[model samples]
Target: MSVSTDLTPPAVILDKPQMAENIGAVARVMANFGLTDLRLVSPRDGWPQERAWATASGADWVLEGVRVFDSVGEAIADLKTVFATTARPRETRQPVRTPRESSRILYDDTASGLKTGLLFGGERAGLETTDIALCAGIVTIPIDPKHHSLNLAQAVAINAYEWRTLILDAPPPRFRDSDPPASNDLLIGMYEHLEEELENGGFFYPPEKKRSMSQNLRVMLGRAAFSEQEVATMRGAIHALARGRGRVLAKLAAERAKASSSSEPPRGE
Candidate 1:
């Protein structure tokens, strides 16, 4: 049977994932819990591999719809609420909740028409401090301190199972028809505009430094899928800033040209 959209789907994001087998295991877990959406952040091994498919078993559809991204921000762009799954605590002091508690909140939020997501880190190392900072909350599975770290797939499975258990007993939440978030074209255009403005502002000058500057900006913007309103708001701010600088530069140039002309004698005289 095909995956049903009647229940609210939890978007599962894998950040810097290590192997295809783990990805497949994640797919299987998601399928077991009736969650379908999967987002990948910078997978070390590319998707749709034989190992992943073999591990996925009956959940090939999840693999088919899995979206691959280059960064965590890109993976959760469209989601309004996001939970980062991590065992280790970070310096930022964000709200940390157990998997069951996080699942209940997610169930409630999604029932109220919020788009939600869960983020999982790589196998060896969990989510970086910066990545955890991006989430609204952190979901940690309770475990013995000596063996706190769980496998990547196991972590996802635990969260999914909790969420599923919450949702299965209740009447499925009404499927809200959310407007398509910012289209790829809009996002690409915004990126181009920002890069150009940064170049004009001398933020990314010196050809040697341009690569890092561009990359940093890309990572900052790629995290969430922006809405149309969000894109417009960002574009407006960029334009306002750029216009202010443009006007200042134009005045300076005009003043320089006028001074040069006044310094010259009349050509016909």
Candidate 2:
């Protein structure tokens, strides 16, 4: 589905977080994944804690605009759909999904003009049954059953990363930006120049192998997909080598003539 320009991702609700450090960590994680809205419900240490900013690293904006609430109901009052993040829910029959699946549903819901949110319990007691009942669904992380519990910040990070992947439209890796590939005419001209020099240098040894060798050379060079500038660069190198060969031949001719004159010496004698 296409992302809408006005789409706002699900807000994150932290219920009764025990540590100021965890709050800062959550803020940092939220910034990493582009989640702008953060709500704190019944934070144990209270709001406006200076220690949080130390742990938030450089994510000051999230902390600067954080919303505080006295209860879970108030925290998500404006949200249309909410998902509770829990390992397991007791007596709750709501639909449950993994992090990735939950992200997809949230993305679609937000695009359709619905306000959404993800509810996370505190570090100590976790979400109460009443709070979970308010959410439409449950998001359970697929961790090893032996250790299903997650750190408060770790849980937020996992969900945030999954959601970010849906919204980010990243391009494939490249070494450097380059112009379009050279035209067929430019390619052919480069090939002919290189082949002419090779032919003069007796590169296509066996007379019968010339055709097959030329075809192989063309195939190999074509695989580079050279840009116009690259083709020009290759042609310049070929021209320089050809001129050097001409100079070498001239030097050899002069040496031969001097030797011949010496052998015909004693003309005066």
- Name the top TM-score candidate: 1
Question: What tens digits encode model 1's per-residue C-alpha lDDT throughout 1-269?
Answer: 33334557779999988999999999999999888999888888776578998899889999999889887767776676688898776555567899888887787667766678999889988788766655666788888999675788898999998887776666454454554346445666687799899888888768898865665564456455466889899999999999999999999999999999999988895
**Candidate 2 error regions (>4 Å):** 1-5, 169-269
TM-score, cand. 2 = 0.61
Alpha-carbon deviation at 30 in model 2, angstroms: 0.3
Q: Compute the lDDT for candidate 1.
A: 0.79
Residue 183 displacement (Å), model 1: 9.3
- How far out, in Å, is residue 111 in model 1? 2.4
Q: Which candidate achieves the best lDDT against the true structure?
A: 2
Clashing pairs in 2: none
